[model samples]
Target: MIKITFIEHNGTQHEVEAQEGSTVMEAAVMNGVPGIEASCGGACACATCHVYVDPAWKETTGSPEVMEEDMLDLAYEIRDESRLSCQLRVTPAFNGLVVRVPEFQA
Candidate 1:
């Protein structure tokens, strides 16, 4: 299992264990981490799963694809480390990953 830390806009921290091969968005939603709406599930059609990847974990998580990049453009508070959580597949190497939710996602 991988450990994912989700920081909410209100500065709340929620850490949960996620199985490998599951999307970060799925793990967050399943564990009630909040802030991850996943409006289109894991299909990459919605930006509700957007999150800011901690700079320290950026290298480990890598960059998103062109499609995911396009979707992020529609997200609020877009940042240098912004990513669509649904596009991030969990792996053993991703354990202890940290992602922060934007203040606005509507």
Candidate 2:
């Protein structure tokens, strides 16, 4: 299992253990982490699952694909570290990944 931490805009934090191969968005929505709307249900079509990866974890997460990159442009409060959680697959290497949700997404 991998541990994922979600920090909400209001400073609330939630941590969940996720299975490998599952997307971060899936885990968040399943765990009821307040900020992920997941309006597209992991299809990468909606930017509602947007989250900012902690800078320290960015190197491990890497950059988004062209399609995900394009979709992120429609997200509110886009940042260099912003990513669509649906596109982020969990892995043992990402066991302690941390993400912050934007205020608008909540």
Candidate 3:
């Protein structure tokens, strides 16, 4: 299992263990972590699953593709670390990964 920590805008932290092939959005939704609506599922059409990758793990999390970057433009409070959770696949390498939910999403 891959361990990931999701911190809400209000500082509520949800630590979840997910399958290697699953996406971060899947882990959050499956674990009932608040703040990730994932309105468009993992289609990359909506940016409701926006999150900020911890700066220390940014390289490990990888960068977004063109499609994801485009969609993120419509997300609220876009930042250098901003990423759509649906676009992030979980892996053993992501153990202890940290993501922060913005105050609002797209």
Number of the predicted model whose lDDT against the real structure is largest: 3
lDDT of 2: 0.94
Report lDDT per candidate.
Answer: 0.92, 0.94, 0.94
Better of 1 and 2 by lDDT: 2
lDDT of 1 by residue, 30-89 (tens): 999888989998899989999999999999899989999899889998999999999899
Q: Candidate 3: what lDDT?
A: 0.94
TM-score versus the correct structure, for each prediction: 0.97, 0.97, 0.98
User: Candidate 2 clashing pairs?
Assistant: none
**Against the true structure, what is every candidate's RMSD?**
0.7, 1.1, 0.6
Off by over 4 Å in 2: none
For candidate 2, lDDT tens digit of each residue in 1-106?
8899999999999999899999999999989999799998999898999999999999999999999999998999899999999999998888999999998862
Looking at candidate 2, the ten consecutive residues that score lowest on lDDT are 97-106
Against the true structure, candidate 2 reaches a TM-score of 0.97
TM-score of predicted model 3? 0.98
